[model samples]
Target: MPQYKLIYFKTTGVSEFVRYLFSYADQDFEDVRHDITTWSKFKPETPYGVLPILEIDGKTYHQSLAIGRYLAKEFNLTGSNTLEDLEIDSMVDTINDYRILFSQYLWETNEDTRAKQKEQLVQEKIPFYLTRFENRVKANGGYFFGAKLTWADLFFVSLKPYVDFTIGFDTLKNHVALAEHAKKINAIPNIKKWLDTRPTECCIQEFLDAKHKD
Candidate 1:
């Protein structure tokens, strides 16, 4: 096995899906988390000065989704064929599109602007995307792609907490299929163990608060 070290901030943001992939695969990795103070010192050393980088046997690679795709393939969480792979990738990217909208609201400095973004996110964007996602999962018989669990399912489930926090409520409330899908993923033994034991700090929230104060 290659020596794997995952470098990211101290919160389960973009890095959480990769962490889930590791847990689901039962792969041991060095999860290196940084705070604002430490990140400043370490930023220059990264390949792109952005995080969620995975060091595989001392060769570091960047990009969260790319790393996820690689790991999913390695762990057999990917689709069986090219067409299935396309569907899985499409679903993951669609989820990412919605996640980016929430991120914009989270980091917005202007209160009025943030309020508007939040309204649009909560009232329009969230429902629009999640309704489609709910129907997708329902159509696929409780999974995102085919008859079995794929990385697309893991990706959505892993990001649920962050999305829920941004929405100030359970984003899955009206989406029954999505709620059940999350339950199914969380029920996995390894994934459950990881969730139960992972770090508890809301580092992203703290960082945003500090930023606004500054």
Candidate 2:
């Protein structure tokens, strides 16, 4: 096996799904997390100056979804065929789209603007995507794609904490299928173990709290 190392911020952020992929496959990796101070010095050396980067052997690569897709294929969490792969990729990308939107709200500096974004996110965007995601899980019998677990499922489940914190409540409260899907993913032995042992402080929450206090 090639030596693997994952480099990211102290927060789960986009890297959490990649960690889930590693856990689900029972693969060992060096999870290197950096705080803002450390990240500043290291940023110049990174491929894109952004994480989460995966170092395979000694070669470094950037982009979270690309790394995730590569690992999913390696771990047999990917689709069985090209068409199935397309479906899984589509779902994963869609989930990422909403994540980007939520991140906008989380990072917004203007209080009034942030409040407006939150209102739109809570009232319009969250429901629009989650309701469809719920139906997709229902159609696939609780999985995100096809008849089996895929990286798409891991990707969505890994974002649960971040999503909940961004919305300031359970984002899946009305989306029963999505909630159940998350439950099933969390119940996986390796995944459950990782969740139980991983650091609990999501830096996104700290960022939001700090902003509120300003």
Clashes per model (N, Cα, C within 3 A):
0, 0
Best by lDDT: 1
In model 2, residue pairs whose N, Cα or C atoms come closer than 3 Å (at least 3 residues apart or on different chains), thus clashing, are: none
Worst 10 residues of 2 by lDDT: 201-210
Root mean square deviation (Cα) for candidate 2:
2.0
RMSDs, each prediction? 1.1, 2.0
lDDT per residue (tens digit) for residues 105-176 in model 1? 988899899999988987799989988998888889899888699999899999988888876889988887
The local lDDT score (0 to 100) that residue 170 gets in candidate 2 is 94
lDDT by candidate, in order shown = 0.90, 0.88
Error of 2 at 106 (Å): 0.9
Q: Pick the candidate with the highest TM-score.
A: 1
TM-score of each: 0.97, 0.94
